[model samples]
Target chain A: MLEAISDWLQSTWLSHAFISQGLWAWPMSESLHFMGLCLLVGSVGLIDLRMLGMARGISVAALHKLVPFGVGGYLVNVLTGSLFVIGDADQYIFNDAFRVKMLFMLIAGLNVLFFYSSAFQKTKLLGPDDSMPLNVKIMAGVSLTCWIVIISAGRLITFYRP
Target chain B: MEALFIWIETSPLSLWVRGESGWHMAFPIIIVFHALGMGFLVGVALAINGRVLGLAPQVPLGKLRQFLPVAMLALVVNVISGILLLIGYPTKALTNPVFYIKLLCIALALWNLRWFSYSVLTNPIYDHGVLPQKTRQLATASIVLWASAIIAGRLLAYTYNNMMSI
Candidate 1:
């Protein structure tokens, strides 16, 4: 069944059209994807740093406003990234580097959900001039590490052309 | 102009970077780290800068400092990883004007970031210290700089004259 799925994807018109068109389309999507990446990194970096005590003057809730922009970045990347898959679904689906990248992305996505569900709810301590709880700190640390790994994996995908 | 390009491309390191060897493996790994480093570094910077400029006022300023180490550490990683990537493809980046633009944007953004971090954003006077009106300008610039840098970096792949041209 899985082999059939791969064969179908390789033989599909969508893949041929996209790949042919992607000479230009690929670069454009890549550009937008990078832009989105910057947004996610920028917003997440600020909040995570704030949580860690680097910028002692910014409020936690205030920093949280940047999350929407981060989400916006993520959305842009997903939309543009799909183009690549549609263009060559089999190439990426079977690629080990691609698989690793997807794994990191999934982990990062889950980490964000975990953050909102648990850390976002602990708002009492998010007050002005209060110390962050250890759990929140841990979350921040994990989020930062996970994001780094995800980006690394994404770049690796290009090199690992299986 | 062709001679200069050739000179760069012929450099021992440049030849090694593109040559099919360990770089085949190293290139992708380093690129991944570079991307991640950018995300962490910029992500932290944007979030902190956004709040400092008063985008989100509910969270306290002091409490947000917990994430700085991550950004700083990521920056360090990028610096190391970026250098490796650069060494891997010295001519590809050196010959490209867009690459220089990306680097310049990053430098200015980081410069502006340093100024904002030390001055208006961290002033101890406001409640958890509200950011000064002036700092917002820096934050805006930071956003622009990073956005441009990322775009320019991506263009490097498309814009550069590849081995076929050489």
Candidate 2:
């Protein structure tokens, strides 16, 4: 089933462009991917650290404003990530490291949903020095760990490629 | 130069780093750390850069100082890992012009951060409003340099003339 999906995705125009766009495409997208990684990690880390009780002088609500940039980074990475998987699906779908990366990303995604559904309002009301609720701290901790694992696994993809 | 590159590449530590000897996981581990270090180092700097550009107007500029320690520690990680990587492939990085550009951009970006540190961050009176023109310029320049540095670093893999001397 996975192989079939990979084949179908590879037949798409997106994969065609990614495969034939000359030498510049891969490096260019990789650069943008790295840039997006930095932007997303930085903004999200700032908020996470703050929620977990570091950077106690910055208000949660104020820092939340930076989420837009993180969202932008997420969009850039999704686009670039799609290009990679679409162009060379077997390289990712059959790679354990890539699978782990996707798993970690899924965990991170679920954490995002949990935050908005359960903690967003209370988080917004948090003052700079207020003690974070245990669950919120858990969310932040999970997020930080997931991102670290996701990045590590993503880097290992090349080494583990099929 | 050739002799120097060969010397470093054949060193025991480099061999270990390159997975030619010792535990084979070292190279991947080093690069993994490098990426994590980048996430913290560049990430925090970009956050600070965003702050300076008035993205989070209510946050005290000095408050951002709380995050610098993590970035500093990450910088240390990158330096150590970067040196190890360079040792493992001196010819690859040294022969590539993009590598030098990346280094220069990083140096200037750090210099830009220092300028922001002393001028804007330390000023207790200026946390919330429009900062001085020069201060904004520093952040803008830091942002540009950081983006360029990352792009150049990525390009090094594609542009290198030699993988190693030996």
Highest lDDT scorer? 2
lDDT of 1 by residue, A90-118 (tens): 66777787788788788877877888888
In model 2, what is chain B's TM-score? 0.97
DockQ of 2: 0.90
All candidates: DockQ: 0.57, 0.90
TM-score of model 1 relative to the true fold?
0.77
Q: Model 2, which residues run further than 4 Å from truth?
A: none
Cα lDDT of model 2 by residue, B56-125, tens digit:
8888888888888998999999999999999889999999999999999999999887777777788888
User: Ten residues in a row with the worst lDDT in model 2 chain A?
Assistant: A122-131
Error of 1 at A33 (Å): 2.0
